[model samples]
Target: LRRQDLKAARESIQAVLKVAPDFGYAQQLAGAIEYEAGALAQAVTHLTRAQQLMPESLAARQLLAQALLRAGDPAKALATLQPVLDGKAVTPALLNLAAQAWQQQGELAKAEALFKRAAALDPADSRTRVALALNQIARGDASALESLQATAADDKGTVADLALVNERMRRREFDAALQAIAALEKKTPGQALAPLLRARVQMALKQPDKARQSLEQAAQAEPANLQAATALAEFDVRDKQFDAARKRFDALLKADPKNVGALLAVARVRQAAGAPAAEVRTLLEEALRANPTEPRPRLALVEHHLAQKDTPAALTAAQEAVAAIPDNPTLLAELARVQAVAGDFNQSISSLGQVAAQRPDSVQAQLMLAEVQMAAKNFDAAVTALQRARALAPRDFTVAQRLAAAQVAAGRPEQALATARALQKEKETAVPGLVLEGDVEAAQRRGREALAAYRAALAKVPASTAVAVKVHGALLAQEPAAAPAFATKWMSEHPQDAGFLFHLSEVAGARGDHAQAEARLQEALKLRPDDPVMLNNLAYMQVLLKRPGAVATAEKANQLRPQHPYFMDTLAVALGAEKQFDRAIELQKKVVALDPKNPLWKLTLARLYLDAGQRAQARTELSALAALG
Candidate 1:
């Protein structure tokens, strides 16, 4: 077994078990083999039998406890170890196992105490010290770095070095982590682990190309390295190379038929590529079946249902996951998110409150609570939650941005502007802050100030589609003549930008140049032929220009966005231009029905009826429009 001849060891263990079915040592050996083979549930069953057969054997009890923990039943692991613990016969191994079980159960204080006890019992043991350092790191103690570094230095090429790298990652000390990885690579040249660690650190540092190269190097160096291959596949998915990722994951599945990570990765890639939801769900379900104790597949299933807008299914999945891991903050947070999306705001808040109580320092939980409150239109409550989150993570730009947005939603534009200005002072390129400032200025009816703010943002982030659109819209609203030159200059610089071309078209239409508007719209459509808004605009301009096939273009736009009233209205106008008054009236009436309160739709409907010579319907619609005044 120590030599990793798993097949021979399993056969020998079975023979021993067959000869002495009641022998505790044979049963324990069988259980250990199953555990090493990743058959955690079978390991638990065999180890339980061994423990029951030899209730006084501490080794059997320890093995059973370890198997139970691996099977995701940490409570059962603690129960299994209670006799030894209660009898005061605790070894360092037993203490470590108990600490791990407690940690899995979310009893961090008890876990840390047990870890400290284990380290004190064996002060020279690097593994126990590494465990204690990991516990301190989890609690955000920077002092853990000293201990972790010492362990890594003393225990080269061991798991301690991996823990040191992980601790550095948790602290976001990417450069230091990379240095340690470099040292480890130098120490153990040609090994895949160092390259794999480098890839992970590179990814965390947002150097995706470097990370990809590193992952490729690791996979090439060790063709059997499942971790490196899986990371490479995930990177492909992130890069939207779905076909390549799927092929690689399929090869992995062929190598290990029940590879749950490969199944989950393939499902995620398929989901991102907009594959059929049922197909993605089947893959996730298969992964779940392969590893019932794993939470990732279950989480993916919930996310899949949520993405499909099957909120009820999502809620059910989330509830089941929370039930399975009641103390897990991540699963609880997922349940809260599902509840919020399902419109059960009260339940979502209750769940979030529980998570906040359990994990008081979790900014994610507080942020989720804020999101739920914002969705409920309780903007003031959202502000409070966001304030808490900001207090917890004061340096997080996202929390600050969300807080400003929430303040704006709560009708505190001045406060929002103040926050945005403060953020702008802190950031070197404050495009988001400038955008928010523009929004607040626009909301206050300061058109000139809003335009200036938007222009400033555009200057900082010239390639930002959103900022460019805001700048163009603000310019058009405040200074129509300047809008054309601004848009034309931007278009010259960004010839292939369909949005800039669309903006130019809008400017042309505003200046009553139907020919120029139609030309610009056609150019924009060439760049983004499937954009329904561009098609609708082009169709509308074609009708105004009295062009041939205007009706066909309008119909195509309407087909692309069947539920859009504006698209329907454009189609009606094209039909009316072609002397199809009855069909035009029908389409106009559908538009009016969609937005009964819109005076524009009512007026259009009245004109359509008048054109159709329906005096009674036309008079009724005219009276309704008059009443709207």
Candidate 2:
């Protein structure tokens, strides 16, 4: 297994398991082999059985936890690690695994502390050092970058080097990323990942031609590299070269007919080209039939049915997938989602309840059940489920917050208020608790109490745009005139808060102060120049003001958030204002298609057609709009 001969190792383990079916050691060996082979479901099942049979085996527990983490069940992973974590024999490896589980749960502070402890225990362990550096980087510690770079330079491993490359790419150092990729390629010769990384870096540098060349080279060097082939096909689709895209997909299918990615890509291309729904559905069904236990194809099939508004079909597909993968959490979640979409709230609740029962140690499962109950307006049941989750994770802010929300929804405002106040006693939840308290008071129409809570939260985190937004909103709801003054004062103190500046712009726009709104938005752009929402708002404002640069501004906004209906609508309106009716009509058609039930967008599409002198198209759109009404 350590030599990477996973297939041989799996076969050897299976032979041992076949002879000694009840032997705990054989089960453990099989589980470890499967885990290394990336068969997480098999790994989890075998490891669980091994743990039950050999209850004292730390190896079984740790391997099971690792498998659960890889399967995206961090709650279960943490639970599996808890016994070891609380024991006297705690190791750096156990701490590192627990840290990863905490990180996945979004408990950054806990994860950081655990990483520090792991690093302290194993100061000579490069992996622990690398993990600590990564955790620090995630927490926005500036010194972590140097630490990570130093670790990467020390030749710790490929993982640390890749981490450095990822960090460089995330920071938009494309040139440095390319150099890192080049170094990695030299260190590990003939790796398909190198060209893929170079291609991504080239694309980030806006060298599309070079990126395409790198992709093609990678595809040629590694014929089985599906990522390279898929990316090239996506590029073809983007350029409207439908035939080229189909050919690429066909070649991929010819090489490996059971390839789920190729199958899904072909289905998406057919959908994009306005093919018959049956044709696309056929492709999705084929993918599902090819890989019954794989979640992606089944989920895609269900999503395709839902997108077509065939709730019955979606539910049936989801049920079939769950029947095939009965123990899989992802497929079960999808089943619940489909049931909820079909308005069978009781069925959704039952499905999630089964998951929670199966994994009683999983806080996530209980939380999911609580969410479904809340959606069904069964607040008491939601609260009950959340309380179970809270018992499992007593210090979890999310579980506590949800419990408070459920109490509020159940009309037990006093209980909710008590929960909120308790949260304020914890350092981790203090500000969020105050915010929640304010929300509860505002919901109950206790205006003064709400204001006081929001003000206290703002005092704790003076630069928090979210708390400031809540304060402004509560003030506005109670006293509209005073709200504007508060926003002005807050903006004066936190001049660099682009989010609050944008909020102030919205207030200015509502009061017919377009000049003030525009000035505020311009100031916000200086802080976050590429913010799509701000760009969209500024474009809409420019269109209303009849500014000549409106089309360009709206184009930039749409480019920033491609295929977003709101941004597309703004661009369409701006184009129409500039008398670019043809493109406006084209864009509006897409916007209306994206939101077919929106009469306003359809009305705009009709107007655009009329402006472009296509009276027949305009009449058709207007008639459809009337039918909608």
Candidate 3:
């Protein structure tokens, strides 16, 4: 008590009690020690026994009650203090303790009454008034705060104004908070707490540049204001600059390694930047160690495990998360998705049902249930589930597409057609719409109508390679007679286009004009000789025409794309005809190797082998061919 080393005093007294076993002086000292040490539970145990031994001691009874109040055992504290409070006025210290405990227990009237009584008992004490003002604000009693502010204004002290301004800041009324801080500064210029409050107000207003200036001033004014530095670090995070934010947080952490806020801020910044998930996991794990009760790190750890596709680790994380946030629908939904992927579908279904009950209109939940139903061959149920999902997300293309597919499978093509048609109509009129009209006509089996759709598509976008090809194919289906003219015109219009040249050559060959076909193919080769499709096209056409020097041309195509099945097959055909049977067999073997299921390659390979007098190899190839399809 003399030295005021509460921890040392408690340890020494406890040591004495341990040795002596019945030392009243040591026990009394322990009570005194723990009350000052703020270990209220330990202090209450020591003080209760000490009060029994020293029965008429007012100091022991007061200390015991205050310790009980600090420990949040307010009923016990109230009983201890009732004798002192009833039929008697209380001291400032005893009232402060009783009010603190009552406030913690949510008994605002009793707390505020004690605070008022304490301030009246010590009218000259600014500290008691500051405590009373804080309690008033806590109770939302604005009148008490007004009384305190007037009392502080009447009093001549910077500390009271500083404390009053801080109370305004705690209320998060930044404008009013700023006015209070300005008042404090006007009263006593360049005070530390006012500048700190001004920085906090600037940060709340999202004026980072101003906040930084204010924080710099606060940190300079009171070098111990660690909160200003922490706030500045968060400002960099608000600006989405992680490297700068990380630097600031790391600098703070370097000076005080146990700063949990700095550590947590760094982790949050990394998470926002999509840093490789392992880094995020490491950060959360470290933060969790500092604050085991915090839900954020545990939840983030679950998300990280999911991202890495470690299902078992994810499950453990999710279980911890659900325990922390038992009613969170998002947590339950994510957990169910993990369970489903790991083949625990029953658990997944139960979890999803809970989420569905909580959020019946959730399109994602309904869609997931429908997909699971479809996988389990419950097609009718899947269709019903999808209908609900579609209603929730009426404009969702995926829901519409899947719903149509399910209808078609359930022998409802007309319904499928109707849904597709409705979607097509919406796209045609909707602003910022995306319509593929060809899909609509194709679904209805109207190839000719699809041709018209593609033609219209071309009118809107003439340079679209895919649309031109689509329209050209549709036009050739039943109007081969019109194709040659269209092909000629198209080739003339786009002279450098190899696809148009290929189409033109096909049209010429169909008309039995071999010379014209050859001229077009030559022109295509001149433009892009080594282009894979062009090379394959030329080689195949040469083989079809039985043209002289076909082997040389096919050889060149093969050299450019050795493993291409079409070029390899063409070279095989060319080689076999030239009586280079062994070379032809090798090329044919490669084609079969590339596409084992393509029996055409096996048949060709066998023929080449037979011509090479390799009957065993030929028979093997023939057997492979016989096994296919």
Predicted structure with the largest lDDT when compared to the true one: 2
Worst 10 residues of 1 by lDDT: 156-165
Q: List, residue by residue over 144-258, the lDDT tens digit for candidate 3.
A: 7786678667777544554455455555667876777787777655434456557767766877688788877765553322455556656665565668767755544554454
Per-residue lDDT over 504-545 for candidate 2, one digit per residue giving the tens place of the 0 to 100 score: 899889988887888889899999988888989998888777
Runs off by more than 4 Å, candidate 3:
1-436, 478-481, 503-520, 555-562, 613-616, 627-629
Q: How do the predictions measure up, each by TM-score?
A: 0.52, 0.69, 0.36
The global C-alpha lDDT for each of the candidates, from Candidate 1 onward, is 0.78, 0.80, 0.67
Relative to the true structure, candidate 2 reaches a TM of 0.69
- The residue-by-residue lDDT of candidate 1 on 435-517, one tens digit each, is 87887788778899999999998888878777888988898789868876877677788889987788778878988998999
Residue 162 of model 3 has an lDDT of 47
Candidate rank order under lDDT: 2, 1, 3
Model 2 misplaced regions, further than 4 Å: 1-187, 193-223, 226-254, 266-282, 393-398, 479-482, 511-515, 575-586, 597-600, 606-629
Q: Please state every model's RMSD to the true fold in angstroms.
A: 11.9, 7.6, 21.3
Model 1 ranges off by over 4 Å: 1-258, 266-279, 427-431, 455-470, 488-629
